[model samples]
Target chain A: MVEIQNTPPHADAEFHHHHAHATTSRHEHGHHLLQVSHLSVGFRMYDIDAPFLSAEQRTVNVIDDLSISVHEGEIVAVVGASGSGKTLLADCIMGLFEPNAEVRGEIWFDGEPMDAMDLAAARGHGISLVPQGVSHLNPLMRVGRQVDGFGYSRAEQTERTARRDKLFSRYGLAPEVAQLYPHELSGGMARRVLLCTALMDDPKLIIADEPTPGLDLDLAVAALDDFRSFADEGGGVLLITHDIELALRVADRVAVFKDGTVVEETAVANFASPDLLEHPFSRALWHALPEHGFSANDQDHPIPIQSTAFEQGGSSDGGDATC
Target chain B: MLEALSITFGYAKGDKPLYEDYSLEVAPGERVALVAPSGRGKTTLCRLLAGYERPWSGEVLCDGSPLPSSGTCPVQLIGQHPELAVDPRLRMEKTLAEAGDVSDELLAALGIRQEWMRRYPHELSGGELQRFCIARAVTCRPHYLIADEVSTMLDALTQAQIWHFLLNWQAESGAGLVLVSHSPALVERVATRKVLIG
Candidate 1:
């Protein structure tokens, strides 16, 4: 058995402290960094071979009515099983949807409605994405130059180099690693490099889609720590992960996703008790946790909570609150 | 029984060996969990057990004899990444046919739909492709099975379903299982014995 050392008590205290301060301060502004309202995504698939001669087309709804928001100085974690539209949500926010994808929703950034053009313009400057697969990296390019994308001017090159070096060292990557190609790096190193690319530009919003899967526990924690620090500095983070334990550690709020929608959006404090959660799926997830003895009884039946619960703002606290 | 006796292996000559005089044994009707962090040679060990790779100095024995050098070994390995293991050009039917005649019961148990058989590997999701791979591997009815993070790409429900089927099959067939995983909770729950490797 792998013995994972307890995170130092002081780290928890520090996180709680920062969380409280950020929550209070951000609420005063009444301005959310990112707001996604009633978002839905569907794909148009065409069947080329048809006996009747006319081609058949069907729309598969991947995400439905998924609404969530991220406030400055807070990390809102989207937690769900795979194929639950978590990655779709991240891709929608990052404007990385495919050509056949049909998106219907209002995605507002910095109090302004954003379209595909606006999102394209804002990408890499106002918003950045740390994609799920490390294969997203350019295999032909050196790791360093890939991280430092398009630094044309001498002054920009100098600044980018300094930032790249600092981030590499922060992630425990060696200076020599910058010279290697994408295939040369180990799984963990490639993951860290993807992180470095997203952090290279100080984007206001960072959408990390399942960023911690291949990484070891320590490196995963370290990556979350960086996200926590980034949020503490008044940036917004939408952390998408299947590892609920890691999410609970760093996220100020948790959005429980089921099917294709947010069933419950609760404070991390609510995770202390199953009864505190408003939705049955959220409670089922809690019961399914490893500490809960890995109960498989509820695996077959994921009891959907009342639609009234979702319609009433989906907050566990029974208040129509947006964090 | 499957045994690795005094195995010494390294990727390159004159390099620090990944496994130095390592030894492990799994008897029939045993479920052994190999617990380790990523990039710690868990895959290497699984490969060695499956006879996909050979050890530099020691031998892998099945029932007190050296593994057959050719043709349908009794030890089967299911790797972590399904995309890397499967053939891109082959349809799911052909891929499953490569192993032998697969049962409809096994396909249902693994939640592999009939429609998937008509599709190629790229047409399916990672989880779907993984289920097909598992089906292909288990159809061989090997005496020993090594699963290297086989269900890591799957969701929670799929993971549970696949594990349940695998455990049931192992119980009935009296096959030795080597489950290599990073999830301690999963290992603790499913494994009869645990072995830690660096």
Candidate 2:
């Protein structure tokens, strides 16, 4: 059984002040770019037997008591196995959860509680997403128009086109690619197009989900460098990926996700040694790294309910336990 | 042996050939990894090897003979996307049956549960579905198998598990294997020989 614990209010306040002060001076009171507190997501599914007759309902809790924060000028990479609720967390944050999903949590963006309208407006403006699937691109539209967000004004279209071309070149895509449809682009080109779409809007927070899957080594590194530079320019990034080594290169902090919730969030430096990471799952991931000889043998190991790291004040501000 | 002799391939009629005068050979009991950046026609090359697509020039040969045009291909190809490869209308068991007789031992080794056979392709996760696809390919007892980034989307543990099973199968059968992947580390660990392509 998993025990749920609420994060202390002071921890949230501390995270807010720490990150807000690090990037801008406009907000006098503590305000985090993104803060999620006591977030829990559960999907209600019908039982295998007697779907309509029985009143029995099964709730599979995908995320439980998870709290994470992203401050200005920080890249927090969430590393986890596939099917470990990583994508669900992103969907919940974007308010794009399925109709059957019951979410109970406090999600604050720019010091304001995010409702449905706020989340819808914040999407692609205040917060941009680099989705994992390249299929997100519209097959019917030209790559340039898709990246430009289909703007109408003549001057705005011209400016957006210039920006799109520059980004395409930076991503190693040819200028001629602008006129092509999504189906015409290669897998790598399509992925770069998605990245260009996310970067098209100068959002405060960027949520990149497995953005480097199909890319080669050099291009993957270049993409990570882009995110690093974006964070350096006072933008927050939530880099969700399966590639721990890639994430470690550009992330300031690393959050290890297990069965559902984040088991440990530590400074990137702590990843130098498995001993520095408090959670077993985090250590497993570290051991599974290619440089570490990929010695992780725990195929059926169950994820622990609570980690010593979390219990020992492993909140956003208190993440420097070993570092 | 599986051999591609001076093959030329391009998606379109007049487009610059993606592969111009490309030649490759794989002997029995050999594991050859094809390393290249994405969209460099790795999948296309695999399709050509498995006779899913014909080459514009030259020929693909198995054991010094051209690949049979019909019935029971000796070369099997497992694509990157398991969803696209499978039929959504059929159950998992039916899909596996199409490949020929599948041993329970093979299914067990690949971590394919018995209950999963009852479910449709859409009901399973990517990793789970991939296991079935791999099982289907190996169960056919092909002389050569081409796996195109088979476990790229899976978790580390699952990836390791699948590789372990495949390596074991290769050892037992002495079948030639062609692994197409972008992962340098995985290629270094698994491949006995490497083929670098742009």
Candidate 3:
């Protein structure tokens, strides 16, 4: 039998939102590996509430004026609450725009205007993205073929096969894993397979979105270490995740994303102490860590972030990132 | 009380048993954290407790009896991937209704907005989908709740919010909670007891 303690858990917790926004000015310096300026994405949707004959359409701004950069040989983590149009940012960079979407922004890759150089040609060639869900792996295809991409000629198939094997070995996957399907692999194996896919083409910049979700602590840390190794070898990484502690573990710099925009970008060194950080949002995140009382609100003031530990946040979940 | 009586199970016939004669017990108001690394059958154990899978031997009992084969089960399980729990074709309202009648107060506490009722699972974020899953699980009025890394994908603030709500719900309902988490800090903060599994 268990002891029954019916005391209301954290009854004193009542949240109220009143936070000051902080802004910083950034100038484009020389040339970085990847730089996005004033990037915004809005989807055009039919107004269901509007009269049918009129058929009014409205632009739902998912991301607005989002500016972030990833330099060669450095890992830049874009930390944000989940569901705030974070993945759309990744989609924009990859040129995977939704139908009826209006886009406005400046994206430069290797100092060249991304538009002038077809981003499609650049994607999977110079830039690779480890999508959030391992389910991105085609369920119908074999693991090796998916990692190797499509091959029409015999020689091309052979070359890609060699490359896939090399990547698999590097990631500690067995030779037989190539024959398996997505469902056949365990969670850790599936994640490693995702990493192998990202590394197949020797891409310079890798964008990993929420790659560590189902992984255990050791595997999660090892995944970050893999990114660290990639950076040490002159590659750049844009790791998008909601876990601040995990991001702080390996990222050299951090870009704090809120409401489809990056509110703060600071060095990881500043995270040792919350006082060194500039934005109030960043401080709120510091207070929300599992090790830090798992509470929300900074000094009884709430600004979109609410935790049951004190008051209610506008949303819930470390889930802010799960979005 | 919830009991796993000397359970033995495996995925395939030829393979060595994943769980052999493993037994455990949990009582109402007890928040038990099951600690183990990934691929260690933590998820399998949760599935067994919730009757998503059947054990090859032994049994899972609730209050000295087997779990109800139909109707609302006494054990409610919320897995890590909310995207998997929801049906892509169904609207949120329909899915929530499947669990029975969910009160507005419960929906409000979960931060589930009215506008979301008409939206399909794919239209909502993973967090929002998870909130729906939580609401659905609670609607069953379970005697025990098993959460398997439910908040692993969320941020710290969102994670805190989820655990806080879960703890409060447990207190109010006097239901047992079984949790699996990678974050030790979270486990320390929420669990009333720790049960290690390998």
Best by DockQ: 3
**Model 1 residue B198 CA deviation in Å:** 3.9
Per-residue CA lDDT of model 1 for A24-121, tens digit only, reads: 12531444678788888777765534555676876666678877877677888888765466776776787877787788988888777899888878
lDDT of 3 by residue, A170-249 (tens): 88899999999988988777877888898988898899888887777677888788788887787888998877888877
Stretches > 4 Å off in candidate 1: A1-25, A47-52, A166-177, A184-189, A297-323
TM-score ranking, best first: 3, 1, 2
Clash numbers, per candidate: 0, 0, 17
User: Local error of candidate 2 at A164, Å?
Assistant: 6.8
Residue A202: error of model 2 in Å? 3.2
Report the candidate with higher DockQ, 2 versus 3: 3
Number of the predicted model whose TM-score against the real structure is largest? 3
- Which whole-number lDDT from 0 to 100 does residue B9 have in model 1? 97
- True interface contacts reproduced, per candidate: 0.11, 0.15, 0.50
The true-versus-predicted C-alpha distance at residue A256 of model 3, in Å, is 1.5
lDDT of each: 0.74, 0.74, 0.77
Candidate 2 lDDT by residue in tens digits, B5-108: 99999999988999989999999999999987766888899999999999999999998988899888899998877878899899899999998889988887
